[model samples]
Target: MKMLINVPETVVSDALRGLAAAHPDLTVDVEHQVIVRRDAPVAGKVGLVSGGGSGHEPLHGGFVGPGMLDAACPGAVFTSPVPDQMARAAAAVDSGKGVLFIVKNYTGDVLNFNMAAEMAEDEGIQVASVLVNDDVAVTDSLYTAGRRGTGATLFVEKIAGAAADEGAPLERVEALARRVNESSRSFGVALSACTTPSKGSPTFDLPPGELELGIGIHGEPGRERRAMMTSREIADFAVNAVLEDLEPTGPVLVLVNGMGATPQLELYGFNAEVQRVLGERGVTAARTLVGNYVTSLDMAGCSVTLCQADDELMRLWDAPVQTPGLRWGR
Candidate 1:
């Protein structure tokens, strides 16, 4: 349960400082808790903004760059950022073309971003919003009313960011973001609970030889916990859960995401089983991404997200992106 931070009180601030030092292309405002791409307010392009709790590294913050988020507001660990943070981010990134807020389905995130959108509009900066509720695991969770946002947050950000980078207007960018979210579904399985910096202990009770299926990113209680299963078994259950909900007829973009602490070796192996299951189900994978994208703090598990893709979505997914966490074709 030991954490590396000097103290729990400054965990978020300390991480921000380190992130600032590590990535010069991002304008990291440690005090205000806003991370923005250095080249923000790109002329004639719709701005993209997203954010959430601090536990998930390389998410909203790490994704600020070309073909992704223009600005991100990092909140306290497992907490939502204030409206001022999002409003400031919106103002900083909004060019004449307006901004789109990509919000996850957590109640706090939804409410705060909604308020921020109003605040931005009050300042004469047009703003649109897309809510992501792609988690097929649960209808309601500890932090959300509907399905909690998980892996597909990455999908929405990447595809919508590509569209925005291509000079799509606010309405189009917003529409594309919503479409990506609607087209994606996710299922997470946790082998172990994550320890928050403040708690210095596991967030939930997950005994040895047990695993939680459909776990939320914050270690929220999931569908069920049972004796630990093999990667192939877990993959079968996770992939089937998504397919049942997604019912995707066309090829899909697959994301085999680690829950922070799962090693790449295990994730890649899990991805193979996931691909096997999809193939058996007659589902084609247009593209497959492995490793951690959206994650819990240090949980030992993985999530599978499937985004039913059309030619346009696939093209956008293939677009060049230069972000700290996800980079390709740049």
Candidate 2:
């Protein structure tokens, strides 16, 4: 498979350079592998930080700005960033108020961020953390001991970041982040396998006319593979999978996310079916966001994430955010 990267070894650095050039408001340290907001260490504000493997674009890195993450540390493609990187990010963003680390549930990420949290605390910077494990698709995977963190990572970051930006203390921000995680669930389906730059080929063998349900972002094995299904069929399966576990008492915030390679047109069509499913199940979509947010590298698929939203969650979700990937009401 052909990729735009100059070489596998420098793919992460090269992308970081480009991201730095594209977003001058962000301080991208390519060598140290940290991306931080230009106006970091906001006085009296709890800092927000999140990160993961490089393949998922516009996630941890693209989200560093005024109303998202204060800092992000990117690892290699589909690899976890080291504890030093996270520690550096925490140091960069931490105001006197404290910093909050938004961690996904993957084992490597969990371990590294936990170590980083301890390191930050030793440095006299009070810290709290929220572990996002909203992927209801699987309780255990190769990368995680519990449910894999996927699309809901975005929700946690946005909502918690909004709270932090409002000068909320570390404790409140951490609680909000954890509440968002607990109120959300996600399920993904893969139409084609992703290709990592290092491998330069499909990560898995997904035969044509077939699809894998419950796929992880790094192309981990999913629940099962079966013959390809239509957009409506896939939406039905994915939405039901999420709703079965979510069981929201009221309205929901829906994210119909493309898994990197899927086009906007297809994602919109799929979102319609997802809405149909929600309506049939007597659920109201308080707000709907579509397009690629949480993603796998060049994977032709999508995921549906549902967050059971109350008035407070909805207010935070609607708050102004000035990030490269997700910007609205700014």
Candidate 3:
């Protein structure tokens, strides 16, 4: 595997150190593998925490800041973070209001976060959780019992985090998070597979002239593989899958996310096609995000996430957010 790294085992640790160095506003607990805002335990606000495997950058870690997550625990590459990391992060960020855990629908993530929630309760910290299972790709995958969580995770964290930042109660935040999941749906198409650091090879194989549809973020087997197709065709396939599941009306939030290796140039093309498809379906994209927010290591592909939006959800989405990965507004 041709990667710029001193050692495979220390890649995650080294990257965490680099992230802390680059963003001083965030604090990295190297010992416990948790990243949180420097000014954590925000007085009366409910804390928000989420985590998963480490390959997807700017996800659980880069999202720690004022209007998003309070803390993020990162695990080894493509592996779930342990419960201790989650418990410590919850303890560090809880400031009386309580803490909410936003977990994806992976088996390991669900189990680990549940254990952490119990541990936090034992320590006198009230906790709530929301599980995101928005990927309409497949009902069950290698790491999950149901649909695997994908791009909608960003929507959940941002919108729900905004509510939490505004001092919404833990139960309310959890409710909003769940609502976002219910309203969102995602579909992915992969032109290539990602190479995990430890394995030092592509997680799966795809012929040069084909792509995998309904792919998971962790490089799990998608629903099917098909011959290479045009951008319009790919966009139609992805957007249609989400539309079939959601059938959203009115304003919606659209995210055209690059898997990893897909260039911004290609992503914009995909975005245009996505907009076209949504327009044809009478769904207007009031808010749109295009680029690499969630990704595999070096996979070349993209995923489309559609969230049915309302006035309240849009207002929260437009709220000020200051985080390493996504920052805008005041």
Best by lDDT: 3
- Per-residue CA lDDT of model 1 for 257-288, tens digit only, reads 99999999999999999999999999999999
lDDT of 3 by residue, 239-314 (tens): 9999999988678999999998999999998899999998888889999999999899899999999999999999
lDDT of each: 0.93, 0.93, 0.94
TM-scores, all candidates, are 0.99, 0.99, 0.99
Q: Which residue runs of candidate 3 sit more than 4 Å off their true CA positions?
A: none
User: Candidate 1, residue 232: CA error in Å?
Assistant: 0.7
What lDDT would candidate 2 get against the real structure? 0.93
Tens digit of per-residue lDDT, candidate 2, span 71-96: 99999999999999999999999888
For model 1, the superposed segments whose C-alpha errors exceed 4 Å read none
